[model samples]
Target: MKRNIVIASVAAAALLTGGTAVAVAGTQSSSTGAPTTHAADAAGTTAGESFSDAAHASGTTARASFSDAAHAALKAVPGTLDSLDLDHGARTTWDAEILGKDGKWHEVTLDASNAKVLNQHIDRDTDAEDAAEAKALRNADVSATEAARKAASSGTVTSVEFDGDRTPVWEVETVKNHKERDLNVNAQSGKVTQAPSDDDGDDD
Candidate 1:
């Protein structure tokens, strides 16, 4: 009977010690949890931080951003800026439409954060759409350049295009800290205003 008691006590002690070891390990594991990914790496940007703020924070400006994009697009194909826009997604894309050397419109997208040229595509074969866009552009007294400048005041302009409406407005897309937004400027007046809505998500 005494041997049985001793054996049971030893077993109970072992169990208690094992449990204590596990508890210590768990505490250590939690205390040294893996380092968190940065907002830039995770592509998680805060909302409401203006584009100008983010750009300034990142050591850039709205004018510089436009200049960088224009330089990159023009370097690839010397052309005039046709239109502009900002693509919202995992990253804010600075997209510019340029009437390229080939005399075809080229869509160029840049990384708003770094102003790295992302992609360039020869936008071709949509004659009807092109005509409408051109007509809208002509009717607008406000240049895409002016719209971009105004947009950079609130945030980084990612894009500028004529809204698909009868009385087309300049659709300006901007981003700050990765949060995307669209603003509208009266084509004739250049009065900037919040857009009524965003367009369908970009295919890219």
Candidate 2:
């Protein structure tokens, strides 16, 4: 009977040791799985943040095209379009100058996003230069839109400004391959030509 008791005690101890080993293995597996889960979650969060940043950047860069802004300006003040410039301020805006039918120059500000008219006012400050520009615009058979189209072959037209020098022309700025190019479109003949560079050392 004593020998039988000893054998039973040995069997119980072995069972206990096996159970302890299984418990330790289970604890180790749980610990390993927890770190992997946390790592996966962290990776997902980082990817989400990166995607959000890219989306925000795209939203901020979105803007109304120059053509749309011009149309909005002309609608606000009916006249001959003179110049349109993209102005960067607290808000992106388009500063447009138009010669109104009332023989006055009107400055119109438009939102760059939706081409909404932000402000409009007559520019009372006129000079001989302004008068010359107006006369040139009146005589030009090629409209600003035409000038832009003619210069489109050069690149994307960014702005169009009137140049009332001896040879009246529409000074159009274009961007091609991320490089800025200046082209002169004859206001009367709709001819496109390269504009003189600032460092060309031409007095005229």
For candidate 2, write residues 85-201 as lDDT tens digits.
Answer: 655557656677777767788888887567789999988878887777777677666666667667756544556777776787878765443356788999778899998888888
lDDT of each: 0.46, 0.54
Q: Write the per-residue lDDT of candidate 1 for residues 64-86, one digit (tens) a residue.
A: 24444544555555544555443
Candidate 2 regions exceeding 4 Å error are 1-62, 202-204
All candidates' TM-scores?
0.51, 0.67
By TM-score, the best candidate is 2
Task: Supply the TM-score for candidate 2.
Answer: 0.67
Worst 10 residues of 1 by lDDT: 19-28
- The whole-model C-alpha lDDT of candidate 1 against the native structure comes to 0.46
The model with the greatest lDDT is: 2
